[model samples]
Target chain A: MEAFKETLLSSFIVFENQLNGQKKSELHKLRQKAFEAFEKYGFPTRKDEDWKYTNLKPIIKHDYKIFHPKEQKLQLDEARKYFLSETDTYRIVFVDGYYASWLSLTTHHQYDICTFSALINRYPEIADEYVGKLINHGDSFTALNTAFAREGAYIFVPDNKIVDKPIEILHFTTPHALPAFQQPRSLLVLGKNSRATVIERHISLSANPVFTNSATEVFLHTGAILDHYKIQTDHYEASLIDNTVYQLQGYSVLNLTTASLGGKFVRNNPIVKLIESMAEAHLWGLTKIDSSELADHHTSIEHIAPHCQSNELYKGIFGGRSTGIFNGKVYVAPHAQKTNAFQQNNNIVLSDKATVNTKPQLEIFANDVKCSHGCTVGQMDENAMFYLRQRGIAADKARALLLLAFAGEIVDKIQLPELRQYVKRIFNQKNHIDFDFDL
Target chain B: MLKIKNLHVSVDDTPILKGISLEIKKGEIHAIMGPNGSGKSTLSNVIAGKEDYQITQGTIEFEGKDLLELSAEERAHLGIFLSFQYPVEIPGVSVTNFIKTAINENRKAKGLEPMPAKELLKLIRERMELLNMDKSFLSRSLNEGFSGGEKKRNEIFQLSMLQPKLAILDETDSGLDIDALRIVAKGVNTLRTPENAFLIITHYQRLLEYIVPDFVHVLYNGKIVKTGSKDLALALEEKGYDWIKEEVAI
Candidate 1:
């Protein structure tokens, strides 16, 4: 851990030197402050309560290359497969932490969809308003990502406008031979009475390990609506740490869903703050992992205002000695009366060696709020299996069907039909089931 | 076409079926009436190849083959079907898809081609109409959120679709209302043929009134103590199983 810290410290100095004389800018000042914070509180270990189930030692031990000098390009045909092939979307793609303008279809008309660096150069005022407002400064991973954030996605929807097309933010790591480390930063803002949809993913093209630490901040103004989905189906050698925070105003709606299907090690931190009355947030996650993979989701929802509502449902299917963790915390302020919050975590452990650990923490200071949570971890239903088998489905096919049904509850909630089919295809591929039967 | 000789079964080392013997020919409908916990379910479950029960001494032959050697699904592939009393709810799998998978899997096991999509759709629509089920019901998850009557009706609907040679109704009349019971009985009566047999397991004689049976056997304490015609079912319904228990004690 110390060796990795020293390496990152030296890399930060070189990263700062390449900033090109923007030292006096507010954004750069924040970067410096974030760097100091990262330096002070290095990587978190298993000793930390939040990181109790996730060990970052194995992920950070590799001497990963932090900078890429040469510009990497992907063929249109090669990159087209990763895009939503069935629907038209505003794409902002990055290759090796560098924006691929030629591969992107961004716009600056009614909506602003571009890279973070482009946002800083063009709309610095907007960047200053929402860039680091909701980030947790005490966390080393978010601080490290902020210190080196430059070329990820920047999406802004102005007031009273509903964008017709969905926005896709894609990061593809094209590592040649050495291990690569990337820090991708994204910011999404929906103005008052506005609406938008965003899809974000991180992919590694090769078998080499690519470690990604990412941070994203979302702001939904009064009467605004935002639907966000994160797809974490990267290579098995890749490890990802994602920190996202959503801040909601009065009457705002935020629907955020994350599907973690692959990756060797994954840790997701999604925090929601209902800052005004009548705000609503729905957080959903589905994780399906096998082998020795580890997927940890630590979510927190803070009901700071009255009459706010939140619903969280996270489900996981573990196989082949995999490990899963779901730690959810809900905090209701004293003044937050009539706060309706419900949370549930359900997991299915497929193999005898697989494991699932789920914990739900609720702190309700207000007496009038309705808060409830439940967690369940068990194997597949034997009665359901027998039912299907008695109907003539083979044992293996029956098992696969049951597992798919267990996951269908979450997948069915995806608003986009094409995206739902894409997720189903990916799930079937991962589980080696031929889902040719007409849905 | 089915025979069970001197069958003795146990679950968790405790005897459930002490000794039972029964025989049925093709085109015959045999009704097994017994009180609760009299091993009625154990008989149906054992015949369906449920792994929870152990057969201490038995020989079950179907179409002159050793039925005990086959798995539940293998038995299904060999033309056996069990209509569950409490049909398991499988969320997310629509009724159409579940039936399609079941039919295709049975075909695959028997070295036959899958039914074409058009043919399957037509067949499903026809069967749905026969069962008095609406089109929307086909899209709902298999038995999920369905009413008690709908589950039993769906079980009968599956029987009509699979067209199995030996169909075991495991307390299929437990939760059905009169209308659902009539529809289910109608489905069974329509599917009966000279090449197939039916074993209806129930606690009441109401279902037999609709679909009259050729044989009514009183199963008491894991053994079939009395075998008679459909009149036996009405007699037991009038006197209750206490008369059967008293006769057995004698």
Candidate 2:
């Protein structure tokens, strides 16, 4: 315990040295509050109810070097290699947790666009207001990220402003010599009657083991609409811990879709807080696991106000000895009447040794609310397999075809033409499935 | 040619085919008629190399090759086909893909190249016409949500595609309607050749009127007690299975 304290204190000192004057001052104040809360509540262990399936000891034990803001040139051709669609959307690139202005497109006239580092330097007051407001500082990982939050992206859509093209922000991590840790944070504020779509991609160029602890806070005001997509396809040696909080106000709509394809260990926590009347949210997620990689998704949808609606569906496909964990909870607070919440988690294990642990829970304090949760875990149907094989398809090819059909349910729901095709391509390449879907 | 000599088989240690023997030469269509629980279906399953039955003492030769020593898939590759009584349903697998796979596997086993997609499609369409099946059946999942008649038609469609040497029909007429029975029998008759044979197992003489057989054998209590020409099936229809049972007892 003493050694852990020393490690935390030293990491904070290193974080302070990497920031400028105004950013350092803001972090100093937030650090003081976060430290107090951290002292009150230490790191969450397996004993904690929410952290039962995922243990963070492996993350804390390693001494991760803080990634400082440095000027580094990125290969533009390589950066644009994976974009599936050709559009006039603005592209922003960040390297090693710091925003790279040279690689980012100019948004001079676009009032809805701003970088996190530029906003922190220009309007410190706006950054100070909503930076750490949505996230719980007592959470050790969140606090650790707050202490070292160097650079990310910030987008604000004013009232009645609709952004036609998706804003793509690419967060790339490059480990030069030693193992590095980067925490890229983003704060999206969608004003009333405004609509926009943001796609956040995390990529790694280095094959060495690295850690990325990312936190994104989305604030949807009354009558606002936001569509968020997170694509995490890092190298197999990389680890990712991402936490996203959606705080919805009255009559706002927020839709979040996440795809986790490549990672050594990935833990995604998506929290939706319906704070006002008639606020709605939808969360859809798909993850494909192979080899010994592990992916865990923990989501919480809280209906704090009356007449709110939320739906969540998460599907996973596990092969080899890989393991997947999904825990979804819907909490309907008191006085939040007429809250309709539905949650479902389904997983298919291809190999005999693969395992999946899914738990869906519903807690309703309001009497008039309709809330339900369900989970299913099973292998492929044998009768179906025999039927296919008798028709003359080899066993292996038949299994692959069924797996693709299983994944089609979620892949078909993606509305973005470019991203949908990109997802299908990635799924096909990774699973070796011969899919002919033209999407 | 197919030959079976004194086949004694048991399922779960219970005797099912007790010293049953039969022979079928090329260009012959033989029907084995029997009542319920008379080991008619067991003979078909055993000939197809199903694992559950134990051939205590039997010798089955197909084209001068030992049949009992081959695996189910191997038997299929060696021109043995069994049209199941109850067809299994597989979702998300199209019928075109299933038939293509089956055809290619058998072709490879016979040291032949895979059929091209264009030619395969042409063959499938021709067979569909022969069986009077719907063209949409080729695109839908294999047997999923298919009606009884449609399932039987699909079985015959597969038979037409495979073109096996010895085809075994195990109660294919059980759930089919009269029209479906006529279409299926027509498909079977069209596929018959001088080098191909068939062993039809049924409980009734209704199907024999469509696809007339050369010989009909009466199976009683796990053994064939009488053998005669096609007229025997007609005589049995007039006189029920009890006549044969009493004659065997005497």
Model 2 residue pairs with clashes: A392-B101, A392-B102
Instruction: Note the residue pairs that clash in candidate 1.
Output: none
lDDT by residue for model 2 (A1-439), tens: 4455566677776666656575446645886677667666767889988788776666556665664447585666777775533356767778887777666763736454768777677767878888888888857777766665657888877777787778888888775566567788788888888898888888877766677888888899999998888887777878889888899999999888888887888999898999999899989889898988888899989999999999898889998888798999889898999999988888998889888989987788999988878888889876455444444445665576667666766776677887888887788777675544241
What TM-score would candidate 1 get against the native?
Answer: 0.96
TM-score of each: 0.96, 0.84
Model 2 agreement with the true structure over B1-250: per-residue lDDT tens digits: 8889999999889999999889999999999999999999889878877666889997999989998997667788888888988887765557887687788878877789988889988999899988878889988877879998898889899999998888999899989899999999999999999999999999999999998999999998999999999999999999989989889889
Model 1, residue A355: displacement in angstroms?
1.1
The two-chain DockQ for each candidate, comma-separated, is 0.80, 0.28
Per-residue lDDT for A176-234 in model 1, tens only? 68888899999988999999989999989968889999999999999999989999998
What's the fnat for candidate 2, on a 0 to 1 scale?
0.25
Give me the runs in candidate 1 sitting further than 4 Å from their true place.
A437-439
Docking class of 2: acceptable
Using lDDT as the measure, the top candidate is 1
Best by DockQ: 1
